[model samples]
Target chain A: MPATQEINIQKLGLIAGGGNLPAYLLSICKDKGIEPFIVGFDGQTDSELMDGHCHQWAEFGAVGKIISFFKSNDVTDLVMIGGVKRPPLTQIKPDLKAVKILSRLGLRALGDNDLLSVLKEELEGEGFTLHGIQDFCDRLLVQEGALGRFQPEADDWIDIELGLKVSQEIGSLDIGQSVIVQNGMIVGVEAVEGTDALIDRCSALQQNGRGGILIKTRKPQQDKALDMPTIGVQTIVNAHKAGLAGIVLHANNVIVADIKTVAKYADKYKLFVIGAPIDKKSKSVTERTPKA
Target chain B: MPATQEINIQKLGLIAGGGNLPAYLLSICKDKGIEPFIVGFDGQTDSELMDGHCHQWAEFGAVGKIISFFKSNDVTDLVMIGGVKRPPLTQIKPDLKAVKILSRLGLRALGDNDLLSVLKEELEGEGFTLHGIQDFCDRLLVQEGALGRFQPEADDWIDIELGLKVSQEIGSLDIGQSVIVQNGMIVGVEAVEGTDALIDRCSALQQNGRGGILIKTRKPQQDKALDMPTIGVQTIVNAHKAGLAGIVLHANNVIVADIKTVAKYADKYKLFVIGAPIDKKSKSVTERTPKA
Candidate 1:
């Protein structure tokens, strides 16, 4: 988004999880002179970050309390930020309203994406505008070019394309949004285990120090407002630890938490960070950002 | 496959690698009064087992010497048995003929499957009848049903089906032939690291003791006579170690080495061994062996 774009929203609701993304979003809201009301999760949200910001804490599966907190604050616009560790259903102490929601969506077979989508729909049904974090913080999205000093080599580009293709299939299945490829073979596919663990596992299995490329993209059917693929300095650091050659992400489709720090880390590690262009014609193949 | 069938071929060639499969094949040949000529890779083949047998040792990629050794032994039919750790190209001391073959097929970009297929074609060109191990030892193929005392529960069946679907897609891309799915989510997909490693990774990521199902099948375009998916006692032991609920193999398409021991292991571990039937219309989805 252009810097000159005028903001119209007055009150924004932030559903915060773990990571610096939530704090960054809050800071952005403050800079734009918008009132931010935060609904933090019990074990996920960073407590210190939300100290002075009007916020309420709820258990991971306390859907009823989360919805009520937003409604009581008269917040009409909401964006879920950061990541939540998927809590076990048995541990979730659901209220009557949460029970109703859980009953409607059978808990036995729902994957993370499916459950998030259900919650997003439920929140939207309550007369609130569900906003993708990008709406308020588009600067976080990386541009379409190399972010660091290094550019992908010819072979690295081939691996990047292969990773993209495999990641699309992975996303289509709602498995996960990252794949590591090297020497024209898929080294790893992200599943329930997140990207860091995936890269760590790949590193253990990688032959020698011959590095692979890591690709992170949005799931084909993912709810943009709920969870978009987010990468930051830690991703670059982890990729380096994993002995990966580079990292490729879809431009305008992924949130690069802090591009400057991320680029600095990439340069320090001699790793290329390329923002792959999303094919607009095939929206499903490469996830699209929410339309303003 | 039936014991009543009389053997006509006098000499059988075995390209041995690490595992009980090659030894099992040789023993079968011995019982059937057929001469077993072994071409063993130095590092991979079980040295002690082939000690007294008529065998010749060659480096992993000594393609020329392997073919020549088979020819000198008057072995017209050949079966590549068990797994060989992929040797680095720099370590491969290819003879003049092997160099010629490698040069014709530029070695830089070929995957394991592609390279194996190329070798299979080259061997066939030399007038040797390449046989899937099943061709000579059909009794090793699992019959469709519950092979052990335990049957797959309903949820286990669901995970098995999910694994089959994912494994098919993985195979179609010529990545790997196995997938582990538990609680309706893919835990792991086999790649270059192979099945035992894949299961080990899945076991690490698996939540609780709720073991998933492991499905192994043939790649869509895989040359069956070259490198068919093989499972045996070790596979059962590893699956048991991985805390997997059961093992599912495409009936007839997979080689079940030492079936009695495998079944015994399955029963002891209370793990179901299922021979899932392949849909005739979709040959790539699940592999089916010839019914006895």
Candidate 2:
């Protein structure tokens, strides 16, 4: 949770995956005069992002190559960003280092959180200090209160509270990080299909009256240094398309990529975007805005 | 739960909703020589199911008319069957009786389970004995063990165990009754979209190696006299189409509509259909069949 200004970035290694967040991070590095050595995944990371950077493309299973690339460039600080689909074990042709790690981990079924945790440990074990995306840029972190002009009503706050409780319960099990609730009923919960798909599926299942709301939060047991729950401009667009009334994210714990553009779209669509703090005791959300 | 044979059902009243369960229940009544006074919901119950049977179509909000119709037929034993979409409050134009009941209940957000629970209480208060579908037909109740030629492998069982735990967790919150799991990851959980849509959504998210397994159970706090988690022939077909290896249902709790055809389809598609007993203490499933 240290401020971006306090962190010294000297020859950082960026493991970029799919999404706009990686490109955003790259821009931040440019602004700060830090040239990060980027390691892009074969099918996951966008090839276009690697155009004018010191980067190397590696398969997800090429753990040895990724490590050596970072080591060769003297990049001691590492940051893993963006989304990567969990491929089946059969599909991943792990190199010697990855095979050794997989074997040591006992090859049981691993969720995204578990996989990332293992990766963090492995990289740290090899004498590299891994950093979260938040460590590089504090601007990307979601702030408290409504980001857009619109604010959720009293009834909407009730749904938000319920959604927070449900999302946290599911997150404790490492299932998913987002949930859609309309009225008092949960329309849908995000799983492996991702948040956008969850919104699309729940659109057809919404009840007759008021639209649903999307609540995204970090998993309770999730490592912040690993994958933090993220929301972007695309999320607002999807929520508007799905007739969602608003979007809620756990304050500070969630990453809001391109916050200005996200706020613009949310305002344009008249959807409220609020980042609320989680009440640890009740395991629910507390609305910061006083009722008018 | 009383045995179906022990319950003397004379002049039964059925409040039929959508899906094949209502039709299936009607056929059972015909077989047992119990002429049920059918009260079908408008836009919900199948029209064909009412042919040759003493039935009346009533809107969901016309509680007064439905009650009088059943009373006129001297039918005191009532059973609410099939699925009914939870309409928005604006959509429902409730009669005086329904309005009184709803107002007395102080309508907050009511899920399907809560709605059904309210209906059960209202009906019983009006001198009607509420009986579950299981009261008229025990044959439809799922039995313990595999129903098809195929049985789940060890890995599938492991996934089933994980699915059971997750589904129960969601069910306890009255969120969902079914969850799809592959390896150790949850692919999707059913909400208002239902089991079929959940299967369809999870198909694209499945891992490459082995297919996922669908685990369905009754919500822990759900009333037995209300809607039971049901699986029909179409469920088996959909599971197979989704490349699911098998399905596991809570034994004796879930309703298996047209079980014979369900078994036939399961065997034809080489998908295992199992009814596993849930261990209440652990809130997990116990595999009844011994591993070979």
| The best candidate in terms of DockQ | 2
Residue-level lDDT tens digits of model 1 in B1-292: 2442334699988888888878777778878888888888877888886777788888866888888888888888888888876664456787887788878887433577887788788889999888877777658677778778888776566567677777877787777889888777788878777898888878877766468889998777888787788888889999999999989998766878888888999999989997886565654334333222
* lDDT by residue for model 2 (B1-292), tens: 3456647765788898899888887887888888878888777788888888788988778889999999899999988999888667678888999999888876442666777888888899999998889888778789888887888887677788888899999999899899999888899999888999999888889988789999999999988889999999999999989999889999888999988899999999999999887889999875455554
Q: Which residue pairs show backbone clashes in model 1?
A: B251-B289, B252-B289, B253-B289
Give each model a TM-score.
0.89, 0.95
lDDT of 2 by residue, A1-292 (tens): 4456547776778888888888888887888888889999888889998888889988878999999999999999988888888778678889999999999986453777889889989999999998888888778788878898988887788788999999999899888999999988899998888999999988988877679999999899888877789988999999999999999999888999889999999999999999888999999975455554
DockQ of 2: 0.78
A166-275 per-residue lDDT for model 1 (tens digits): 78878887778998887767888887778988888888766554588899888778877788999989899999998999899977778999889899999999999988
Residue B7 lDDT (model 1): 42
Worst 10 residues of 1 chain B by lDDT: B283-292
DockQ of each: 0.43, 0.78
The DockQ for candidate 1, computed on C-alphas, is 0.43
Docking quality tier of model 1: acceptable
